[model samples]
Target: MPEIPNEQKKAKMPKSVPFIIGNEAAERFSFYAIRAIMPTFLVAQFFNPAHNPALQSIAEARANELSHLFVFFAYFMPLVGGIVADWFFGKYKVILYVSILYAIGNLVLSLSTHDLSLFSTGLIVIAIAAGGIKSCVSANVGDQFDKSNLELMSKVYGWFYFSINSGSVLSTLLIPIIYKKYGPELAFGIPGILMCLATLIFWLGRHRYVKVPPTGVKKENFMRISLYALKKAFLYAWKKVFFNRQDKTVWETVAEKYSPEAIDGVQAVYRILAVFAFTPIFWALWDQNLSEWVLQATKLDLHIFGYEFLPEQIQTFNPLFLISLIPVFTYGLFPLIEKTGIKVTPLRKIGAGLFLTILSFIIIAFLQEKIDQGGRPTVWWQILAYFILAGAEVLVSITCLEYAYTQSPKSMKSTMTALYLLGISLGNIFTSLVNNSIANNGFFARYTGASYFWLFISILSGFFLLYLLVAKRLPEKSYVE
Candidate 1:
């Protein structure tokens, strides 16, 4: 292939790139718009007016917890959707179908604030759609480029992530304005419109996408083969090694199929499964930003430019911080580290990111302790937390996206991306579990809110450190350019 000039490469993006990015921009706008207002909306819509004054606080707490739980599940549904896409439909088909479902979810949400049951159901559908679409879209971007132009793939993903943050920032700002001024109906309705636009954007690029076919029976056969080998190995270990049976048939069969030479597939499975074990801790910390952290902010002194900020607006800083820092880290810090011969492998970056997460929580914990002691924490405290968290996100999330796409086998690319997302899903489930535990007033009752949060962060950081130690030994793989 002839070398394409830098200017031409800049001007001539892949055909499908615009549509995919456009879709993401609109979809994120819709999703974040709803998410930004959900907690406040739930409090206003679900808390019982007729309740006793004493129980109102409890009722509001329950409402907030339930709303965050809903958000958690919404974030998680991609795991199932991703599996389905890998096993059944191609990524394109899955995305198209799920985008419609996402639109319906928005519509359902827009239609009613009075019916809590219906609203919850709508949110569930949205989660399913979002999950289904999330894994496929990034993988699809990789599909657009082959070996000839693969080096540009990372740049494409960077742009993709940039678009996501950009959309999120806009929606974060607009959703609050809509919620505070126009009310829930308009606030919810606007997102629904944006979702529809996102669907249309996706459809417009149908022919441009380099669609990959589903794996179908080949994937099933591979799984079956792996399972059979594993079973034989276990049986042989029991009979020959332990029981000292005369039968060596199982041992022979296991060696023939699952010997060290043929274990890559099995090793991949084990490694992927192992990563999931610690994923939920990440999610638990992530969910706090929207639920607990925002709630905590309401109690702080947030007088900025003579305006008392809404709790939800605190989230805007996360994306703002991300946008500002991406350029600085990409051009400045990364180059300095490279020049100094400091290695910045994905695993190391993730470990560093995990450590940063601990710092973010420590900042939060300190602020909370001060607030508990009758001191008003500054808005800059929240800004600082967002700054640290955003840095961690850049290291972990962007690198993970690259890792998931490249490490996966050609046929299972979407599946690998889905597994990557499953971490977030498990994280959400973890949040739900924690929230439920706290609500029950059993084991966690001894700790105050800040202490409870600090404990969770400390535990997560420890788990993340362990994960990095183990993952460090695993050999890296990259099939994509």
Candidate 2:
């Protein structure tokens, strides 16, 4: 092939980029709008509102459990969606179809407000729909560029994350006001409309995308090759234990029909998964901005400068801070650090984020202690904590988005993205289990008030030290070209 001109390479942004970013913005708005209101909405709709502090506290705790559990299911569905896209259909089809389901899920939530069972059913549908398309949409962005413009992938992913937080900031601020003013139906209905718009925007990009065809049960598929390798290893172990004999080494036992590329992709998947193992701890601390943080806001003095802030609206600070911080980190902080003769790797960023998370939770723990002592401290304390948390999110989440794409093999891109998302699901499960245990007066029930935040702080501190050791040893790779 002839060498591509430098000037041509400079104009590397794909036409389909706008469509993907627009769809992501609208879709994120729809998702965050619903999520922003879910906890308070659940407590208001189902539990006692008669000013009984004991019942109200119990109700709020249950709301936290239910909310986190819903998030657990939402994040878990990406695995199924990734498998379907990589093996049966392509990314575009999966995104298009699942987006329609997403719209329906929102509609169901809008109409089912009065009935808990119906609302729970709506949540389940939304979880499957939203999580299903997530991995495909992200992987599809990387698919748009090849070796000619692969350097632009990181910049595009940054913009993609910016679009997500843009939607989040708008929804987090607006949805609470809408819910308070109009009621659940209209509040929920607006998000459903936006989801439909997101679907339409994505569908308009169909012909522009460079759609990768599915592997479709091929023997050379990454999963097939990995499974064969595992089977060979098992038989080799069995023979050694009983017959006292050995066959070929494990790596040498992969099926011959599979190409070297397929085997390499399987190996890449394992490495990516190892890095993903430490992410759940980060997410477990981060996602509380949706539930526990908002709940904590209610105990604070929400009035700031003659304006009363809604508890749910306080969650807006995260995305708002993200909108500003992403650019600062991408354009300023990272470059400044690079100029200081220090290398900034993804694992390093993530490890630093773990430390920041511990700090944020310590602040939260202090604030919770004040609340328990009947001192309604200003909301600014939490906002200060949000500032720190937002910085950590910039380091961890955006870096992971770029890392997961670049490290993945072409054939398993969506699957690798799904595996990364599985970490979020696992984190939410951890949060849910903690909440459940507390609700049942189990072992965790002993940790109350400020101690709750301290518990996470301690857990994350240990993980932060361990993640440093892991990052030191973990190798980095890139396959964007």
Candidate 3:
């Protein structure tokens, strides 16, 4: 008799799931711990004392630029990581190797509190270390399920995200306080220790994992097709412009050289990339939670329940709210929406997130106006912004994580995930450039104070419209089955 089809097989959780989730939790704790303290630490250690009333704006601006640049590099390096994992090392080996670098980077940071060059070198290494494995980890989680239990994949991703925020909530709340009472050394050291633990946790699951071997450097690989397509386009352009010859289109030229499957794979990558193109603005607004939002909190009155909260600590709300919001949306909100005879698709969720992000920034702009006019606002206003932003994040970030994996072709999963992450990298780099411009008195520097928030709101609104246009025509293909 023919064996049962995998889809008809019972859904079962993989034994390796716990290890991935646990490793993610510890790893996120390490990342967020240092991130929570970075803005204030930069000002304290590099520019001027954190508390000095002189050149405060300069110090804050410098902090924002450096912090955003760091985040940019962290997100950007995933492209290299994805390429390395998908083409040569495989996910398990790449993650294990870079994780060692990750631990060392944190140790370097912990020891270099007094030396700017040492700190900068350490930050670059950490960026490479963290980003190098970022795509592999999540993609690896998806690798654990086959068509036999593909139905369980979404739930696993939810828990995966839940663990990430759980770690974030703890670190964001605790680390800044450590930085305050103790010093940067211990605050940074703890994350290094946690990273080593994260590595150990991952290693323990080695035998249980469903390891996907690297595809090696095949001619039909996505990277090869992409590179060939580029070369063809360049030659085509050169011929068209100089030789006054127009024969075949770029696609025609590419098709001449690559297989149909390879060409289709590259086209799929382009389509997914098109969807991702609109997302950088969302990230530009989202990552501000760590940089600009923290600065805004510093200007507010942070005392509550007889304890003064650090401005950096206030960002704890994003992850804190996320820990609660994930389940509510997964079990409560999504199911409730579907019951109304409406299908809750990924694009719909992302649209809702984009709209909510607009609302959050509007609220932030209003609060900033009050502050710009010399009125001290309550911490609660920013808290509200954080809550709404958290809701947007639940809808966008979590959905993208699941959607990217489910939609990617098997050969291109890590590459697609890396592209999704590149949006964050681009967003942060955009943010860094904007802040750098403002610091150096470049164009649009006059849009300061509440106007700065308005500028982002305007950009996000325009992009949301563009997203709607593209999303409607975007094709969906699932490779998981």
lDDT of 1 at 339: 92
Best by lDDT: 3
| Model 2, position 429: C-alpha lDDT score | 88
User: In candidate 1, what are the lDDT values of residues 127-191, reduced to their tens digit?
Assistant: 77876687678778888987557777888888898889888889888888888898888999999
Displacement of residue 87 (Cα, Å) in model 2 is: 2.7
- The better-scoring model by TM-score among 2 and 3 is 2
Q: In candidate 2, residue 306 scores what lDDT?
A: 91
How many residue pairs collide in each prediction? 1, 0, 0
Model number with the top TM-score: 2
Question: What's the CA error at residue 419 for candidate 2, in Å?
Answer: 0.9
Ranking by lDDT: 3, 2, 1
Q: Estimate each model's TM-score.
A: 0.84, 0.88, 0.86
* After superposition, candidate 3 runs with Cα above 4 Å error: 1-19, 50-54, 142-159, 203-212, 230-253, 304-307, 330-345, 402-407, 468-481
Residue 260 deviation, candidate 2, in Å? 2.5
lDDT of 3 by residue, 1-481 (tens): 9999866778899999999999999999999998898887887788777577655666666778888888998999989998889779999999999999999998999999999889988888998889998978988998999877888999999899889878988999999888888999999999999999999999999999999999877778776777888888899889988999998887888888777777777877887776677788899999988988888887898986778889998998887787778889999999999999989998899999999999999998999999988888888889999999999999998888778777776666666777888899999989888878876778856667788889999999999998888888988877677
